[model samples]
Structures are given as C-alpha cells and as structure tokens.
Target chain A: METFILIGITGIGLGALYFLIASGLSLIYGLMGVLNFAHGSFLTVGAFVGFWVASKMGFETSMPEFILAMLVGGLAAGLFALLIEQLLITRLYDRHIDQALVTVGVSLVVGAVLGGWFGNDLRMFPAPLWFLSAIDIGGAKIPADRVVYIATAVLLLVGNWALLKFTRIGLIIRAGVENRNMVNALGINVRRAFSTVFFLGGFAAGVGGVLVSVYSNGVSPLIAATYLIYGFIVVVIGGMGSVPGSFLAAMMIGVIRQFANYYATGLGDFVVVILLAVVLLIRPQGLLGKVRS
Target chain B: MLRWKYSRPLLGLLIALLALAPILGANPLSRPGLQQTMAVAFIWGGLALTYDLLFGFTGLLSFGHALYFATGVYVSCILINHEVVVWWLAALISIAVSALLALLVGAASLRTTGITFAMVTLAFGEAGHVIIQRNFFNLTGGENGIALNADRIPSLFISVANTKFIYWAALAALIFTYAVIWWVTESSAGRVFAALRDNELRVQVLGLNTQRYKLLAFVISAALAALLGAVMLIAAGSAAPRFADAGVTISLLLMVVLGGAVTRWGAVIGGIFYSIATTRMQDLTQQESFKTIPKWIGGPIAEPALVLGLLFIFVVMFAPGGLSGAYYRLRLRAITKKSQ
Candidate 1:
C-alpha cells in the first residue's frame, strides 16, 4: 500500500510536468489549429536558457534563484515562439500539413543549435528553497520537490481554468477555436489573439521545461525529441482543442507510465502510445472531446 | 531552331554517357559505387513517386508510409536469409505483403483527413518502429541489424562485377517504375485521384467512393515503396529498421515538395537531385574556400543537416514549386518564344 502511494505520488508529479507542456500544445491547436511540433523543443530551449541564466548570474549556491532563472528561460522561449510564428507559421496556417512539416524543420534546427551550444551534456539548476527536505506521509516518504511540482501544476491548472472560464481573453480564445472567421467578423483581432495564445502556450511550455529539467536533474539535447513525441501523444489522447481534457489525459499517461516502468522494463516510451491507440479506437475524437457534428 | 524538339536524343546521349562512365570516369558512381547508389536511388525514387501519387496529386499526406516499406523490407530480407535467392519471386511476395498492409492502414486512417490522418500515420509508423526494435533478438536483429551476404540475381546476365550488375538491375527497375507512374497518371483512376484531392465530399456526392480510391492509391504507393526496399536490401546487402525510420519518410516528403509534387517526373528528378546534392555537398565544401565561411559563420556549421535545414527553409519560403517547376517554366518560355 505504501509503495503504491509512493508510485502514485511520483506519477502525479510526472502528470503535472506533462500538463505544463501539453497544455500549451492544446491551446495552440485549439486557437490556431497548428500542431506546433516544435513545442517540446521550445520547452528544451527554456530549460537550457534557465540553466544558462543560473550559470551566468553566478547563482551556483542559491536555491531560491531558480525561479528567476525559470522566468528568464520562459521569456526567451516565448520570444522564439513569436519569431517562429511571425516568420514561418503565419504563412503555413492555411495548410496544416505544411505547418507540421515546418515545425518539424524548426525542431531539427533548434535541436541542432541547442546541441551545438550546450555540447549534449545534461545540466541541472539548484532546487527551490521549499524543496530542502523530504516529507513523510504515513509509512511512505516523498521528495519535497515532487510535492512542489504537483502543487505548482495544480495551481497553474486552476489559474488557467479560471482564466479560460472567466476572463475576456479566454472567452475570445474559445470563440476563436470554434470559428476563427466568426470571431474575426465579431470585431475581434484574430491574429493578435493567435499571437497572444502562442505566447501563453510557449510560456507554459517554458515552465514545463524548467520543471522537467529540474525534476530529471538536468537537460539533454535528446530530451526534446524524446518528450516531444510524448507531449503529442498526450495532446492526441486528451483531444487537441480541449484544455481540461489535456489535464485529465496527462495524469492518466503519467500514472500509466509510472506503472509500466515498474512492471515492464525498457517499455516506457510506447505505453502512452498503446493507451492512445486504445483511446482512439473507443473515442476517435478523444476523451472529453465533443464529436464534430 | 527546332533543335530542342529532338529531346529523346539528348536523353539517349545521357544514358550512353552513364553506360560509358565506368570506363571513362574515376568517380564512385562510375565504377563499383554506381550499382549501389543507382539501385538505392531507383528504389527510393520509386517510393517518392508513389508518395507523390497520394500526397502531391491526391493531397493526402501519410507520414506512416515507412510502415508498408518496413513490412516489405523485413519480409524480403527474411526470405533472403532463408535462402530465397530469386529476386523476382521475392519482390512479388514483398509487394503483396506491403500492399495488404497499406490497404488495412489506409482504410482505417483515410476515415479522417488533415491533422488526424497525419497523427494516425505517425502513430502507426512509431508503432512499427518500436515493434521491430523491441523484437530485437529474433527477426529484427535488434540494434546491430541482420547482415546478409551478396544478393543473388538470376543467372541470365554474364559474369560481370557486382556493381555493374546492380547498376543494370536498378536502371531496369527505374524504367519500369517510371512507366508505371506514367501509365497511372494518364489513366481514368488517376483522374479520380485528382478529383478526390480537389474535393472528397463532391466526389462522394457524385456517387464515387473516395475512400476506396484513396485506399487503392495508398496500396499502389506501398507496393512501390516495398519494391524500393527490396532493391535497397539487395544493394546494401542488409535491412535495418532505420530504413523505415521517420527521417527517410521526411526526406522523401521533402524531395516531393522540392521537386514539384504534382508532376510525374518531378519525384524522380527530385530524388536524384536531393541525393546527389546532399551527398556531394560535403565533398564540394571540402575545398579550401567553402570551409572558411562555415568556420567563420559558426564553427563547423558546414554539416549536411545544417545545410539541409537551411535549404528546406529556403525552398518552403521562396521556391514553393521546386526545381521541376522552374524547369517547366523555362521550357514554357522557350517554346512560347519559338512559336512567336
């Protein structure tokens, strides 16, 4: 029972990390209908930026300074997203396949650049101040950092949910997702909205990058290729245009992956895909996804 | 003034030059390397043409094409391992296996269009890759991959060098592939593929089963890809899972896009051009002059991937119609001026 709890907690932490990354993909797909294949690379960029900031600022001994590092990393990632959208994605939005292909190209470019710059070695930032000790629950001990990640993810989810459900921008975004032409005709600047969503989405991916980098104890060049595919799987399983759906799906994938890791050696990557296939068969539009009339 | 009308003579001259290359030239393709590259390129070009049959013409881009290619490659490679020395017979079986797989995958996947289709194809491709990779100890040979001795062809041809035989075989296959594409593109079925591309709903409203047509297109494409894989195995003397990896699929897609996808000969030219240019770029930059800029711009930025990435970006942003499109435009201009 204790072991299960520990496993479940780890799973929750993973799910949270996934949610941060996948939510951005969901929003971009929802509003712009662009798959953003380079989103994982964007997260990677952020992670690397955070590492650079920590190193550059000489925050070697400081744990609390990583938040500042994360912010800087996220800003850089957002800027890169903006540049990609402005230069390439804007031209290919009408052609989704082309959009996918271009983003794939972007992924290769970013990955290569990152590898060239960072030298393929993994680097970690100092942990947050709150994660100094492990917490014991019943007979199970869980890392304080893992709890912090879960809390941060939940907080972000609630904050995003509230923003989407209650804010004017969220309402506009929802409208845009349903029908971009209609939203444009209703006097909303759809392009600006799209740019805004991309920025927010990129910001979320950046945060996920920082969290995952810290969680895994470092960032590696190959991590983008590895986890980007997983993020895509999560988005597909959750439903492309659904935010809450991603949250639910992320948790499921996270838990299932943890279970698979424990049960099946050397089969972590495809567990999500198998689950995705099963989900796709039962509900083609995906779980929490409304059927397209 | 009417000199260009005899284009067939020019084509014949090119073929003659290719035939005489081994004797006259010192390049790799002139001697032992000719067979390997030609066979590989012909097979790959055939696959690209098939991809264009669906994507360039039909507008249905399936990223999971490697699935069918793998199916055929693995089957043929396994048969060869078991001493199935007859190339023609193995090719038929391989084509059949791949065609069936294409039919199944296309049938299910063609139900959805656009992003869903792309995602499903990717799913299938990944599944295929993982399945082959995990069953390493058995048929796949795991990471190390299965190696075979030299491929055995029919005893009809005289005892020539392995490279010369391979060159002739690949050239013949290339001719056959080109003929098939030419016939298919001019056929009634080809017209329907075009219609399906234009508007599937409209075709369905016309009482045509667009899905059936799409499946047919997919199966044909898969067979060609499989045939190409057989040639590759024969040429390389081995089959690795990397043949079915996503990079090859993307590279093929890039070739189609860069060669003007809708044109019949575009894929062939594109494949040859992409292969030659990418392969030769490293050698070209090996000159003292080319190395300095790459070093200065970014240390060792002269890598093929960097060059490829830059080239692809340029093509996407500027040369949307690709090299073949430029050729067509030039041809049109020349013809119009002559008439005037």
Candidate 2:
C-alpha cells in the first residue's frame, strides 16, 4: 500500500509537470489555431534563467526566494513568447503552416545558441533543502515536492478557470476557442486572444521548466524536448484546446507510466506510445475534443 | 539558349560527367574523400526528391519521414546481422516494410490535416526513435548502434577501397529516383496530386477520394526514401541511431524548401546542396581562417545549425520559392525584356 501510495503521488507530480506544458499548448492551439513548435524553447529559457537567478541570488535555502526565481523565469519566457508572436507569427497572418515553420526556425536558432553558449551537458539546479525531504502520509514517505506540484496545478487550473469565467480577456479567449468565425463576426478582436494565450502558455512553460529541473535535479538543453514530446502526447490524448481534458489525460499517462516502468523496466515509454496510437485510432479528436468540422 | 528543348541533352551530359567524376579529372575532384562526399550527396538528393512527392507535389506535410528512412537502414542492418538474411533480400524486405508502414501510418495520420497532421506524424516518428534506442532482443544494438555484418555484405562492397563503386551506386539511385519521379509527376495521377495540393476540398468536390491519392503519394515516397537508406547503409557500413532523429526529417524539409517545392528537380538539388554545404560548414569551422575571426562573432557561426537555421528563416521569410524559384523569376524577367 505504501509503495502504491508513493508511486501514485509521484506519478501525479509528473502529471502536474506535463499539465503545465500541455495547458499552454492546448490554449494556444485552441484559440489561435496555431501549433507552436517552439513551445519547448519557452520552457528551456525559463529553466536556465531560473537556475541562474537562484544561484546568483543565493536563494538555495529559502523557499520564498526560490519561488520568486521561478516566477521571474516565467516572466522572461512570457516576454519572449510575446516577442515571437508579434515579430514572426503575426507577420505570417493566416498562413498557419508557415507560422509553425517560423517557430521551428526560432527553436533551432535558440537551441544551437544555447548549446554554443552553455555547452550540452547537464547542470545541477539548486533547490530548497526542504524540497528533497519527505513527509509521512498513510505510512508512505512521499517526497514533499510532489505536494507542491499538485497544489500549483490545482491553483493554476482554478485561477485559469476563474479568468475564463470572469475576465473580459478570458471571455474573448473562450469565445475564440469555440468559434473564431463567430467571434470575428461579433466584432471581437479575436487576435488579442492569441497574444494572451501565447503569454499564458509561455509563463506556464517557464514555471514547469523550473519545477521540472527541481524534480529531475538537473537542467540541460535537451531536457525540455523529451518532456515536450510527452506534453504533445498529453495534448493529443486530452484533445487540443481542452484544459480539463489535458489535466485528466496527464494524470492518467503519468500514473500509467509509473507503474508500467516499475513492472517492465524500460517499457513505460513504449506503452505510452502504444496508448497514444490506440487513442488516435479510436478517438481522433481526443478524449474531450469536439469534432472539428 | 535556355529552352526546354535542350534539357534532355544537357541532362545526358550531366549524367556522363557524374559517372566519370571519379576518374575523369585530377583536379581534386577524383580523390577518394571527395568521391565519398559526392556519393552521400547523391543519396540525399534521391531522399529529398522522394520527400517532395509527399510534401510538395501532394499536400501532406509529414514531419516523420525519418521513420521510414531509419526503418530502411535499421531493418536491413538487423536482418543481415541478427537474422542472417542475405543483403539483397534484406534490402528488398526493408523497402517492402517501409511501404507497408507508410500505408498504415498514412491511413491513420491522413485523418488529420495541416497542423494536426504534422503533430501526429511527429509523435509517430518519436515513437520509432525511442524504439530503436530500446534495443529490443539485442537486434537494434540500442544507443550504441549496430554494425553491418562483414561476411554478409556483398563482396563488391566489402573493401573500403571500393568507395568508387559506392559512388556509382549512389549516383545510379539518384538517377533512378529522378526518372521515376519525373514519370510520376507527368502522369494523370500526378495531376491529381497538384490539384490536391492547391485545394483538397475542390478535389473532393470533383468526386475524387483525395485521401487515397495522398496515401499513394505517401507510400511511393516512403519506398523511395527507403532506397536511399539502403544505399546509405552500404555507404556508411553501419547503422546509427542518428538516422532516426527528428533532425534528419527536418533536414529533409530544409532540402525540399531550399531547392524549391513542387519543382521536379528542386528536391534533388536541395538535398545535394544541403548535404554538401553542411559537411563544408563543419569543415570551415576548423580552418585556420576561422581562428583569425573574433571569437564572439565566429562562435555562433561555428555551430552549423545556428547559421543554417538563420539561413532557413531568411529563405522562409524572404525567398518563399528557393533556388528554382529564383531561377524562374530571373527567366521571367529576361523573357519580358526580350519582348520589350
């Protein structure tokens, strides 16, 4: 029971990380009808910056200060996302494929530059000491950091939900996702929603990057890409543009991968990929996605 | 002067030169090293042309082409080393398997279009990459990669000194690929592919099943791409995980775009040019002249991806038509000038 509890909670933690990346992908694809290929770059930037800030500012011991670094990292990524949106993506207008291509170019440039500057080895990310400690729950010593993951995901979900429910920007975004043509017909500047969604996605990517670095205990140029694939899987399985669906899919994938890996050693990834194929074959629109006409 | 009437003779002359390249001249062109490079370029030329059949001629923009290419390489390698199959039989089987896979993956992936199509293909390719790395049954050799069995390899290609034969083989593959593509592009089915690219809905409105046409293009291109892999496996004498990386597919995309999409010969040019330029760029970084340049400016330039990536962005942004596009534009201006 204790082992199951430990695996379950950690699985949820992994799912939380995936959600952080998937939510942004879902929202952007949902509203803008654009698939941001450079989305993983956003996370990479945030993680490196967050690590730099925490180390330089000597915040390794303080929980609040480290959290501050994570936010700063997210802010940097958000700003970068805005720049990409305005500079490259918006210029292409409605050429969706071209826009995606530009993001690929940007990702390549960024990836190479980072590799040139920092080299391609893993670097340890400093986390608060308490993060590594475990708390006894149901006779299982679960790592305390997982609680933070679940909490952050829940908080972001609720916060995003409230924003979509209450705010005018969120209203436009929600409307845009449902029917862009309808929103445009109603004289809504649906374009504004694209920017908001990119920024939100960027910020969330940053936070996830920092948090995942802590989870893995290291940061590398290649780190986000592996997770990004899983994020893409989560989005596809969850259905593009559906936040709640992403959360459910992420948790399911995370938990399944945990137990599968435990049982078969190196079989987790392959199983997940098989699952993705099955889902794609059976439910092309994803678990909660609307039938796109 | 630039008439299409002279194209056939010009192509014949070009083929003759390529065939005689290893021995025709002593001006640093016939060296074994240079021949090896040219051989690889020819294979890439063939590979890129096949990719064009799918992305350029047809409307599908698949990002997982590396899966087919890698499938050709690893399957052949494993069959010979592990299953003890003959090299010729292994090559044929790899081609067959790749085509069959293209059928299945295309059947599923074709359900989506545009962005979703790209993502679905990418997911499938990534799955292949991971599976190769997993080294199931010790056949794939895992991350360390697998070597071609020496005794199983054909006697003609056994010695490293026989690189010239490999060069001829690669050139033959490229010519064969080009001929097939040209024939297909001029066929009635090829006409449907152009229509599909321009407007799929319109094709559907014409009462044609566009999905079937797309699958046809996909399978043909995949089989041809596998041929390139077979040639490459013989050229390199081994199979590595690098062949399956997403980067390889992106490189194919770069080739097609740089050479000019939809144009019959553009992909060939793009592939050869990209392969040669990439190898040259890495060499440039090691030159003494590079040391004279400032470290800051030269540092990023040394990373070929940074330079090539920026170039790709420029091409996508400013030169939507690529090299062939540029040639056509110039020819258009010249014709107007002559008339005036």
Candidate 3:
C-alpha cells in the first residue's frame, strides 16, 4: 500500500508536468494546425533559464524567489517562441509538412545552440529549502515539492480553462481551433489570435520545464528530445487539439509509466509506444477528440 | 512531354557516371578521401531513393524508416556472425523480414493521416532503437554494438576491409536500386502512385484500393532500405543501435527534400551531396584552425546538426523544390530564351 501510494503520487506529479507540456502543443496545433516540433526546445530553454536564475540568486529558500525564477523562465521562453513565430513559422502557415520539417530544424538548431552554450552537461535548479522537506499527509510521508508541483499544475490548468471559457480572446481561440478559415472570414484577426495562442503555449511549456527541472534536479540537452516524445505521445493519445484530452492522457501515461518502471525497467517506453499504437488503431480520433469531417 | 524525351539520355548519363565513379575516385589526381566518401555517398543515395518512393511519390511522410534499415543491418549481421547463413542469403532474409515489419507498421500507422502518421512512426522508431539497445543486449551487444568477425565473412564478397570493393559494391547497389525505382515509376503502378499522391480520395472513388497501393509502396521501400542496410553492414563490418535512431530518418528526409521530392534522380543526387557535405563539415570542424575561434562564435560550427537545421530552414523558405527544381527552372529559362 505504501509503495502504491508513493507511486501514485510520483505519477501524478509527472503527469502534471506532461499535462503542461502536452497542453501547449495541443493548443498550438488546435489553433494553428502546426505540430510545433520545437515545443520541446521551449521546455529545455525554460529549465536552463530557471537554473541560471536560481543559481545566480544564490540558492535562496524563499518562495517568492522561486516564483520569480519560474516567471522569468516562462517569459524568456515565450519571447523566444514569439521571435521564432515571427521569423520562420509565419512563412509556412498553411503548409503542414513544411511546417513540421521547419520546426524540427528549429529544434535541432536550438538544442545545438543550448548545448554549445551550456557545454552539454546537466545543470541543476536549486529548489527552495522548504520545498525540499517531506510532509506527513494522512500517515504517508510525501515530498513537499511533489505537492507544490501538483498544486501549481492544477492551478495552471484551472486558470487556462477559465481563461478559455470566460474571455473574448479565449473564445476567439476556441473558434479558430475549430475552423481557422471561418474564423478568418469572420474578420476576427485569426492570425494575431493564433500568434498569441502560440506564445501562451510556449509559456506553458516553459513553466512545465521549470517544474520538471526542479523535480528532477537537473536539466540536459537531451531533455528536449525525451520530453518532446512524451509530449507527442500525450497529444496523440489525448487527440490533437484537445486540451482536456491531453490532461487525461498525460495522467494515464504517467501512472502507467511509473508502474512499468517499477516492474519492467527498460520496457516502460516500449510499453507506452505499444499502447500508443494500439490506441491509434482502435481510436484514430483519440479518446476525447471530436471526429474530423 | 519534354521530360519523356530527356529522361532516357539522363538515365544513360547517370549510369555511365556511376560506372565511372570507382575509376575516377581511385585516380591519383583525386583527393585522398574521395573514394571512401563516394562509397558511403552511394549507399546513402540508395537509401534516399527508397525514401523518395514513400515520401515523394507515395506522399507518406514516415519518420521511422530507419527502423527497416536497421532491422536489415542487424538481422543480416546476426545471421552471418552466427554462421546461420551466407551473406547473400542473409541479405535476402533480412529484406523479407524488413518488408514484413514495414507491412505491420504501415497497417497500424497508415490509419491516421498527416501529422498523426508521422508521430506514430516516430514512436515506433524510438521504441525499436531502445529495444535494440537494452532488451536484446546479448544479441545486439547493447550500446557497444555487434561487430562481425572479419574471417567469418564469405570469400565470394570482397572483404569489408577493402575500400575499393566496398565502393564498387555500393555503386552497383545504388545503380540497381535506381533502376528498380525508375522502372516502378515508369510503369502503370507508378502512375497509380503518382495519382495517389495527387488525390487518394479521387482514386478511392474510381474503385481502386488506395490502401493496397500504399502498402505495396511501403513494403518495397522497406525492402530496398533493408538491402542497403545489409550492404552497409558488409562494408562497415558492424551494426549499431544508432542505425535505428530518429536522426537517421530525419537525415534521410532532409536528403530527399534537398534533392527534390517526386524526382527519382533528385534523391540520388541529394543523398550524395548531403553525404559529402556532412563529411566535409565534420572534417572542417575538427581542424586545428577551427578551434582557434572563440567558443561562443564557433561553438555551433562544431555541431553539424545545427548547420543542417539552418540549411533545412533555408531550403524550405527559399527553395522548396530543391536542387532539381532549381535546375529545371534554369533549363526552362534557357529554352525559352533560345526559342525567342
């Protein structure tokens, strides 16, 4: 029971991170119809930036410092994404395959640049001392950091949902995702809306990256590839362009991965891939995605 | 109409060039490293040709094509290393197994369209790489990779140690692969592939089975890729799990697009050019003079992948048709000017 509870907690924490990353990818794909392969690079950028800020700030234990670091990290990533969107992505808007290839190229270049700058070694983000402590929750001792991460993820998810549901900009994005051409014809400036959504998605990925680095204790150049694959799997299983579906799929993958990691070691990834293939075969539209006409 | 007249002479010229490559490469006036580079180039060219069949002609963008290639290399090498079969028979068996694997992957992945198809294949490729690296450690030698004993290789084939033999063999393979692709593309089925690429819905409405044609293309492309993989194993004397890496698939896609998709000959040219460019770029980075530059400025230059990425973006934005497309446009201009 103890082991199961621990596993469940860890899985949920990891799922929260995946949810953040995959939601960004799904949102962008929904609105812009581009897979944004470079989304993983945003995560890497966020983690590294957060690490740099936290380290430079001298290992402060205050919650405010950590929040500031995360904000800076996310904003940096968002700015980078905005530049990329303006410079390269805007040219290949409707060309799906070209967009995929171009984004992949961007990812490779960004990864290489980061590796060059950071010397290809894993860099750690110093977590606040209080968050590092363990807390007793109903007879089970859980790491305080896990609880913080899960709480942050839940907050972000709820905030995003509210923003989409209540705001005019969010409504425009929702409409654009369903039918971009129609949204454009309706004179709502869909291009600007898509660009904003892209920025927001990158910001989410950045936040996820900061959280992951804090939890994992370090970040490496390879994180882009690893998380990109996970993000892709989540988006696929959750159905492309579906935020809630991404959230559900991310949690399921997280728990399954934890279980597989404990029982099978190296087979965890293979099992996830097999599950993806099976899901694709049985439910081509994804679990929560609407059927495309 | 113009293509019909020019294609025959173009093919003849290509065959003649390939036949003359070994001789040209071995000449004293040629650069010292040219022979080995050309041999590898031909091998990659063959792989890219097969890739074009799927991505360019058939309109399927598979990101896991390296799975088939690596399967061919590992299976053939394992069989030969274990003395279960001769090299020729091992190659044939590898092709069969690779085709079977392709069929399964195609069946599962082909159900989705566009980006979904690409992601599924990418997942499968990553899984295959991990399995080869971990699950089959004994058979695959894990991360260290499996090396075949030189003496165990059959005497009928030239030893892998001989660069000349490998070069000639790779050239022959490239030629043979090109001929096969050319034949297929020229035939009725090839027309059907082009049609499918243009509009799968229209073909389905015309009472043709689009799925069958796609499967056929997938199987053929996989088999050809596996054949090249076997040839590579024979040349290199070892196979690594990295052969199945997603990077390989991306590189193959880059080569196809760089050469010009849908143009059979373009893939060959692109593959050769990419191979040469990458090799030269790596060599340039490792030079003593290159290290003299500051880390921040020259750091990315040492990473070939960065350069490749920048090149891909440039190509996508400025020259979507690739080198072949550029050549065709120039030639069209020349013809028009001459007529005027």
> Could you list the iRMS of every candidate?
2.7, 1.3, 1.1
* Cand. 1 Cα-lDDT: 0.75
What is the C-alpha lDDT profile of model 2 across B256-305, one tens digit per residue?
A: 88898888677889999999998999998899988898876777678877
**DockQ of candidate 2, scored on C-alphas against the true complex (2 decimals):** 0.64
Residue pair clashes in candidate 1: none
Q: Write the per-residue lDDT of candidate 2 for residues A170-271, one digit (tens) a residue.
A: 999988899999999998887788888999999999999899888878777778887788888898899999998899999989988898888887788888
What tens-digit string does per-residue lDDT give for candidate 1 at B1-340? Answer: 3235767688789777766666675766665655556666666677788788888888887878887777777878777677764666777899898988888777667766777677777777776777677764487776656775444545433234656766666666667777787788789988999998888889999998888888888888888878777766666667787877766777788788777788867887777777767667667767887655644345325445565666677777777777777777788888899889
Tens-digit lDDT track for model 3 on B259-278? 88887878999999898988
Better of 1 and 2 by TM-score: 2
| Residue lDDT tens for model 3, A93-150 | 7898898888888888988788777777777677788877777765667788888778
Task: Report lDDT (CA) for all predictions.
Answer: 0.75, 0.87, 0.84
Worst 10 residues of 2 chain B by lDDT: B1-10
What's the TM-score, to 2 decimals, of chain B in model 1? Answer: 0.87
What local lDDT score does residue B146 receive in model 2, on the 0 to 100 scale? 89
* Two-chain DockQ for each candidate model: 0.39, 0.64, 0.73
Best of the candidates, lDDT: 2
